[model samples]
Target chain A: MTLTVRLPGPAATVSGRGQRWAEARAGSLLALPAAVYFLVFWVVPFAGAVWLSFTDYELAGVPAWTGLDNYRRLLGDPGFWNSARVTALYTVASVVPSIVLALAIAVPLSRPGRVNGVLRALVMIPAAMPLVATSMVWSAIFADEGLANTLIGLVGIGPRPWLTDERLALWALVIMTTWKHLGLFVIILTAGLQGLPSGVFEAAAIDGAGPVRIFARITLPLLRRTLLFVLVIAVIGAMQSFVPAFLLTKGGPAGATEVLPLYLWATGFGFERMGYASAIAMVLLVAMLALSLVQFGVLRGGDDG
Target chain B: MTLLTRRRLLAAAALTTASGLLAACGGSEPEAAVPADGVPRGKLSVWLHQTKAYDAVFTKLLHSYVQEFGGVDVTPLYVPVDKLDAKLLTAFAGDAPPDLFKIGGWTIAGHARKGRLAPIIPKAMGVPDEKALVAQYDQNAISSLSYQGRLYGVPIDYTICCLYYRRDRFAEAGLDPDKPPATWEEVAEYSKRLTSADGRKVGLQWILGNPQWTLMQLLALVKGKGGGILSADAGTATLASDAGVEALRYYGSVGNAKLSNPLSGFGLFATGQAAMVVSGLFAMDLFPALNKQLVFGESFDIAPLPHWDGGQPVAPAYTWGWAVAEQSKLPYTAWHFIDYLQREDVAARQLKDASLLTPVKGWEKLPGADPKAMEIMAAAAPHADFGPRTPVWQEMAKALTDAGDAVAFGKKPPERAAADFDQAMRIAL
Candidate 1:
């Protein structure tokens, strides 16, 4: 008698519950492919790399556990220190100029104009160009008899060895990296600038704020999140700077431009020190993580202020 | 309700199917192919760094071999010489590697030490009888293919360093085009005479920034003066010895005398701006293509490297060869291809086509061969000395270059640089 009473509306309730369950099951099943891909490609390789860092793994032979030996060797190695210093110098030198140049260009170009679209498209050309092609073109430009020197010479400056001189090699790399990445930074920052609410700027203008004042107080403050995003990206890009250092310098001019990635490549590929390379990669990962955290903290603090 | 759910499910499935099909259509063609014969079924890939003459010859050779041996299909992968070592190592570490490859002699020991090389003597391909091969190559050239007292590779070509001069430039500069320099002193004297600064043209050009070539030439000078870069056993660094220091000073003096233009050397040599340049026989094929007439001469009078004051001259020889991977499945097939390539007729044709000197027994003396090729072979055959043959030869070579660059760039005195180089060798060795 109780069941018969409940059955009066239970059919609809049961159907509703069954539909929700089916939808959730379908959603999870749809997600399964991506989950499998991520597990196989990313997670497995990353775990393997970390595990290999603790072993004496030569590429040609079986890996044997030799815990901390690679780390110990890395600590005492002068080359490692040299690489760390160069990497830091490279990051600061490349990222700072890139961001500054992007901001200077993008902020102005974000405004409407007859040539704004053309100019923005032009800025993105370098970003679309292949890294190897850019490096090759820059190599020609930085050659001893290249265009950079030709221009410098016209200004009554002596032809300097841009790629060959130890003192100037890193600067050459900085210029190359800045040029290569300026387009990307501009695109990101321009998007951020474009997304800012125009009403805030209009209000500022109505209050007798000049263009510079409006930008400083209203526009910039509002674009903080976007700038933070660009900063994070630039930092990551700078830390992984390889192509410029590799192609232009070959970590040369007496190892003046050697960085961690190049050193890792040389050790693993050139010298066949797989475990050591893995260890270096692990250190690089940790360093990158620490840098990201620091950048995050600074961004948060700026937002609060 | 069930019908509606089924419709939604079918639509989602259709979307995924369309996306996957689009992806498949956009992706590159799958490399794996089913072989006609069940034997030699997998892909047979060869990695090479020769993008010019050797590359052309290799492509042709691969075609011939695939026609000759029907089971295996071959793919030739090209890498730049500077990037080859790194790429090979990365590929070897992964699940797939080229079935066979050619590498520089300096790289053999390092790869062999890691057991990456297929031992030709016992495990894989049996070593060829040295006596049955060409007579132009010396024992040392054969020794370059050996690791730990066993042969691991087959010699392909020998590239000897010599003085390449522009016959027209030398004649124009009032130097005898027929007779090049016979000694370091002679080279300096000729360079000074040939050097001219008309507007912007400089006479002799040498690459100052490159340490390897500069150091290798310097080592030749040292050996010519009766000294070696290391002990015979490779137990010590002898770069700071009197002969070594003297060699460095001499090489530095070429830059110091302003006989050679450091700024314009690489470009000038390519453009025929320099009257005489010290380069390898490998450039013989290139000169003809550069719209220039080139004449070949030995390091000293088409003889051995110039003799020191009272010592016999020593010339440095460069050899490159082919090695089989230890992990290879078809060792006999690999051996067959290598042996076939070394046959007199095949070797001669390759040498003629590629403008390379074959290391096989008597391909140099083949009738109707290019005269310049013959002259180079004759000049380089005697007094040829292979560079240091250690597992760490590349590192040692780098160390030597660092020292040489210091001298070439005038960053440090030759003596001081040699000392530093010796110290570096000590650490690296």
Candidate 2:
């Protein structure tokens, strides 16, 4: 009884800290599986690839560490340089045609109708078709005596070696790739057009704006975000392109069509130079990241008005 | 349908499913098919290319092996030619690879170096030694399977690179149909004589644009003139040597003479648009089907690749063989199956059914064999040899082919082409 003293009041609960702790625990619980997956599948492999880039790995023995040598070799490799150039050129060539043709097709068929529906469906046919079958059909079409040449003969144009000629094979890839991928971009832009409020277009038309004026002043400005999205995706897809070059030209006719992916594949799997290939892969990854950043930055800054 | 009963059932089901998944993840390893016993009894997987064309052959041979020996189940998995190598690399990295596979013998050396293959020891095969093994098969076929002085596969098919000529086309060009060129000079003359005046038809069509195809085809010219595309051990490029330049000039003469074009695919050869084509033995099998009027010996025939002036003929060849994977659990069973396939009757039957030339000795005399084709194959067997056996062969092929195209189509001089090739190969090596 004598020792009884006034008990200190229960320590004040820091309400903000309590709330934050509970919220963090809940968030961690929700994100654990995804975090684990990313760590295991992507981050781990990426780390391994980075490590491998510094070593000589041929898949048969212990990887010997030869730091920076693979990267050094890549700098001096003419084949690597040629492939990088091809990859860059192909990315530009394919992305531009795909976006332009997609927009051209999308604008005309933007309005909803039965005929438009059928035409859109027909346009989507090539995109739906597998690249393997498409390659065979295109190969047949490009033959010296193939359907493409046969069709062009009516116009007094001679047979063009679509795939067999070194000067033309890369261009042929660009054309076929445009045809295959145009439909997706068309659908995306069409969806974007349909999402726009039609009242703006109507107001512009009522204000004596021509169709061209309406497009330039209203449509293009509104679709800038969608266009940028499509451009970045198209760029990435074109840079990573493989099958058309692999199946059609086999990176041949004196390495005329040897894009970066094909070259890295040959170096890694074909030549058993996994370390060198990993170095190539790191370079490709960095280049792709830089491209995406610069493009998004420039496109975003270009508008903002 | 009551909620309480359904909840209980659902809980039971979830528990059961989770247990089943765990069990599957930690299941016992499969028992080895080949044991220390009378006969092997289990699934024996055989991987090969062109399964549609070859399933019957593998089915028959493997079935007979099982019937004679003991109990074993065999399956043939067909992979496309383009995907086979990559598929093999993936399979080798995986824990379970095919027990047996058929692949180009020339590629065996590369696979061997990767430790993906097991050496085909003659003693283990029940043959006395490699000499006895060589006695039963064509040496040329066996040579391609050898890696570092040890053979790693059993050669089954000899894909001989020969000169396939059309008699009708040659006669159309005012050349004697009965005579074929035996020398490279004669080849040039024949090309001149066989080409049509209007240029609608050509004298020859070698696969030109593809570096791999062009280089392999041009090996005949290089090898015939006492030259080679690689070092003896296949570690360096010899394609820049004087002999190689001479070979490129010989290859370029086709375009220079206007006997062929650069972009012609095998279609030109198949449609008889070209009189003579440098192709493989397999081309003959497609002639009658491709060109209706064609008769085997009457319309088309194969001749050993023509040699350079006063030089020995060279039938540059590629072979496909049966190899045992290093991951094979039933190695004995796999080897035994290959052993059975190489038996005289089975090897003979393959040529007849599969339209592939067998490497087994006396395969030419097998039933369902054509007399004249057999004669040509027999004559060519002694001279047939493969390209460089190094894993770098793909690059070597590309360099030589680039040289070939520059000289042939780009009109670059042989010396210039060789210099470029030498420079490229310096990087490749």
Candidate 3:
């Protein structure tokens, strides 16, 4: 029921304030279940991980409280250091190409044409596929006698060990990662392009500006915020890549593709060192946050320029 | 919001609450007790790994078990191989482990040490005594199932590796189709002769898909060179000994010989792109049915797996077994079920249907099993032994595989791999 109050005074003093306040209270109560769910499921588990990181928790037995021991060990451990280096390389190799390729494709698909629309739809098919199912195809594609070599062989390039070759495994993973995720970014950038102001473009065209000039001065600067979101999400996604590495290489050909997340999993389950895995995960979380913040700052800093 | 909307929301919330409460009330036990004479009466939950072609056969066997026992309601749980470890761990941690679980034989000792497996009682197995039971299996097989001189699980199947060669490939290379290479030197020579000039068709296909598989096969070669991967007590790794180094060098040179065209041995051998492999009876199932080029006994044949020229022949036994869980309430019932499956005729039928070799003696003489396949396995069985029997055995296995991979990649020579393998085992143990 709609309730109202009557007061004979100034317009500001009249009526419906209590009803508005009641409405807000009702809305908050409706959201309480979702807030409680997040608190119980995500917040509590995250807090538990933080607590376990400082201790020696193997999950099979009682966890012993050992202050900063896991962290100290992680810092000094050669495997941890190697994994960090590999993760960094993997993040860069996957993210930079993904963003560039996404933008490159988005620009073509953003135009008004039937061909562009059809091409956009076709490219988005992989984005809908389950990564686990696609991983099998990728494994086949990266095999020694896979289609990659077959195609390369046609031009006399001969066969190359795409997965087994230690130097190339990370790159092969990067390329596959890009193939799987590039469609999402393409759609994001395409939507961003659609939201771009047409008057500005028309004005630039009227002022005798070329496509390159207009894009350089207007489109890129305008798309900074969207690109920033894409970059941050990409970095966070790249850091946590596990299934592909797990199924494809298993961090092998000499631990060349052992990203931080893969190492974290191996330590936790394979070796049953949960505390050390949690400690490494905490570090990864911090790295992801820091990189995301830096991306925000740099992308925003470009607004003034 | 309207009164009607509020009323509808309240009804929805109440419905959800009612459903939640209903779900929280777990299922009750069956009202009727199992009517059996000697058999224990209860619901028995047995967890087995997934086998697409044989799960139904096992389920049928379970039904027969139910009919024989009268009232025991047996629940068969099939876990996928990849997820079995996680599920078992979760089940144990949750204090709701199954009555019996089929696990890799190599891990029987490891799990037994963790108090996960219940010791098998001879009475439960219908044997006169534990002595008689122990006497039934070979020394190595029996010893592998025992922990601190106490038997804990029953070995069901044994996978003994042997040399599988293509008769057509041999004929193409102008070599003897009847006699496969019997020594490392002969294998090396045969590999070169059998390899295609363009390097497309490989001579020998090794288990390069996973390092663990490679390490398992290499154990046989390592044994022939007189280097034990682990000590008798599984206390120390002796992989860096003179014999161990020679074995590593020998295997490394074969891998490095460039005779291995494709690393995927299963696919290469199935497609007839590779001539030979050291494999189990798994190929007997895949090749005859799936291989477009293969015809059983005519195009392909098996012999005892080759080893070093001057060394004794060896083959690694990849075995799995069934054990009653310590947490089981129906331990006797579980044992009865396992015992039923292991009876002479039933055991032969079960294994034969799956193209698997039995762990029991005289299975070769039983009906249903492929005679030729049994003959080949029996020839190798005398020389077969499991990898190792330590709590840290798997860790050592990993180290061996890593060292083998390093050898394959030329990152480490055989001597260095052996040295590093010894160091790794020390760290792992």
Q: Residue A119 deviation, candidate 2, in Å?
A: 5.7
Q: Report the C-alpha lDDT of model 3 over B164-240, residue by residue, as the tens digit.
A: 88999899889999888988788888988887777667667676635456666778777887878888777888888
Candidate 2, residues B1-429: lDDT per residue as tens digits? 666688899999999999999998766664453355535556689878863445777777777777886677788788877678778877876656798998877677777887888766564466877778877877777777878888788787677677888888777777777788878888888877766666556676677765556766778877777778877866666777778888888787763222223235455666777778887766666666566788877888777777788888777778888898876766767777778787777766777777676677766677655667677777887777777777666666666776787677654798887876766666667
What is the interface root-mean-square deviation of candidate 1?
4.6
User: What clash count goes with each model?
Assistant: 1, 0, 1
- Lowest lDDT sum, 10 consecutive residues, model 2 chain B, at B255-264
Model 1 alpha-carbon drift over 4 Å, by segment = A1-36, A75-82, A112-118, A140-169, A194-222, A252-256, B1-87, B121-137, B171-174, B189-215, B222-231, B235-267, B292-304, B307-312, B361-382, B410-429
Error of 1 at B236 (Å): 4.6
Models sorted by lDDT, best on top: 3, 2, 1
Q: What is the C-alpha local distance difference test score of each model?
A: 0.71, 0.77, 0.78
In model 2 chain A, which range of ten residues has the least summed lDDT?
Answer: A7-16
TM-score of chain A of 3: 0.92
Ranking by DockQ: 3, 2, 1
> How far is B328's C-alpha from truth in model 1 (Å)?
2.9
Docking class of 2: incorrect
In model 3, what is the error at residue A19, expressed in angstroms? 9.1
